[model samples]
Target: MGKKIILLLTVGVLAAYYVYTPLPDNIEEPWKLTWMIAVSKTVAYLNLFSEFLGANRFVNIAALSKRQEVPPTSDENVTVTDTTFNNIPVRVYVPKRKSVALRRGLFFIHGGGWSSGSFALYPHDFLSRKTAERLDAVVVSASYRKAPKHLFPTQFEDVYNSLKWFLRQDILENYGVDPKRVGVSGSSSGGNLAAAVTQQLTEDPSVKIKLKTQALIYPILQILDMNTPSYRENSHFPTLRKSEVAKGWYDYFTTDRSLENAILLGQLVPAESSHLFKFVNWSSLLPEKFKKGHIYKKPIHGSSDVAKRFPGILDVRAAPLLADDARLRGLPRTYVVTCQYDVLRDDGIMYVTRLQDAGVEVTHNHVDDGYHGAFFLLDLKISHRIINHYIDWLKENL
Candidate 1:
């Protein structure tokens, strides 16, 4: 019995090593290798232990189950009104709570890589309520129609019109929110919208709604180049891979039916203009410190058919980082959060540098060990550490 037990233990140890070890071992970058190993260990542990204890599997199933649950307090004391902006549908979130005085107001846009996301997907809807309770603020979370259906300028127009509606309604007087303290915020694609809205507001002479602050969390500020160091390093990272990033742009410009398999073969952007756009100069504006772990290379040009199919991608609104220095200078007080492991980290860093160079007041937060979409996953207990950091920053800044 003792001999049999020893043999079994040896076999188990060997199995564990094999499961955790990643093949190929050809990942050139040290950090990439380390990150891959860590992810491999995580997956190995989940696969090996999940069947026996089922803890990881159970948690995943529970999360899916939770996504189906109607948000308990979303409708209570909160009024959701449907309206049309530039022929696009939008839903606004307004708190019904009584206030002692005027409050701060937030114009929020949802994130889905500019392709998919709704106001309901925000975990902070409850937190937005708490913000209303604490800061005496009126949070307007807008549900703008997404891409492929609405196209590029349509979403931007919808958001702009939503802001116009807020101003038209005299939200400050009715909701007891201070017009001077109005702000805009969002994560990922929504962050891009927030930045764009802030820029457009600054440019518009007719619109008197001035944004006091802007919050951008891991935003995709540019769309020109995909060959940044972060992209090469985190190309295979799950959830938001390089291919998926390209696919997002494809889906945004063309409808779902237009997404043929050939497009995925790098047939989206034209070859001549592929290198003509200023993606790296604008998007790769990362601080020298952020690039210590990787090397920079000139981006390889894309095929001619690729560019011809997606010409609208070169627009400044689609790639806000490409906006000139004059526009960057006109932006409001900005707050940017970046994650070390995210492909979009450099984009945020570059925007901060541009804003600072333009003399815009900027508050920057770098999450060293955090990954993309970490803060949005706060409802999950596994991501609590990163979530706490985000909440702490919001408390101090917002």
Candidate 2:
């Protein structure tokens, strides 16, 4: 009996080692990496189980959170309110201090790959309130409709509508915010939506209330070329695998999953749109330092037939990287944060380059030890410092 028990224990230990040892090189700490791997695998398994049960996995996971458990208003000097903008639900955070002058306004969108993120989530909730107090600004965190339920343009519409609503004189005066000092920001898919809003406003000069600044945190700015430098480098990184990233875009863009396989394999670029390739081609855009050890090959022609079926993939609002240079000019000052290990790193870098070339003032911050989801790791000393730096930059710019 004792010998049998010892053998079983040995097998269990070996299985755990096998599962957690082969982490990506970018993750420097072994203990943290192991914990992250375990958490990721557990979530994956839970999501699979939820799928089998025919339930919304994200909603189920979110149900477990302690809702609105942010720091007390008295302590944080921030007031939190739940409200709706144009009938779309939103959460607003305002600093309590009375101001002689109107404060800056920020429209913050949460990141969840256009699906799972919610302001109700602890990190986001705390971050919003903390931002309002720390920056002494009126912060509005939007809850836009997600994809696979509402579809492509719906998500963008919600965000755009909310921004317009916030800029109204009545709303601006009520929150002690200056209309001209308003800015838009987001992370990941939220960043994509923020860029879309900025692009939309830039194209239509008739809009009276213009944005003063834009902040993007490791945003997925474009989908034209999936073979970016960071994409190739972190292809199978556990935090966010390249295949999974492609699937998220596919799910958001199309109702049918039939074309997903082709899309993932790089067979979606139409021949007529080939000229657009130069904007996203890694060989042309990325610095030599990022392309050192990675091999570059000519991408096989994606089926134009498949590409024609999904025209929105090329839309400037959907792929802001393709926006005209003229449209990029006379826009707000921008702040772009890139993570060294994130698959979306090059997307931010390319955006900064374009913004600078267009004569837009840009402040680019690259977190050397950061990963795609590093912002969620508030407990880690490194992540905490990075988060502080990000907040500090926002305050200074505001």
Instruction: Name the best candidate (by TM-score).
Output: 2
lDDT for position 298 in model 1: 48
lDDT of 2 at 337: 87
Off by over 4 Å in 2: 18-29, 53-76, 293-295
Question: For model 2, what is the C-alpha lDDT against the true structure?
Answer: 0.80
Model 1 lDDT, residue 11, Cα: 100
lDDT of 2 by residue, 1-398 (tens): 99999999999998777576465555557577668777768768887798789987657645544342443343448878889999988888888788889998999998877866687677887778778887888989898887677677888889888888998888999898988788998888888999989989876655778899899988987776677779888877777888878877876788788767765666667777778777776676667777776666545567777777777687877788888788888678999888888899999898888888899999988887778877766666656776787788788776
Candidate 1 on 103-175: residue-level lDDT in tens?
Answer: 6777777777675656654465654555454554677777676666568777777787787666544655766
Whose lDDT is greatest here? 2
How high is each candidate's TM-score? 0.73, 0.92
RMSD of each: 7.5, 2.5
Count of clashing pairs, candidate 2 = 1
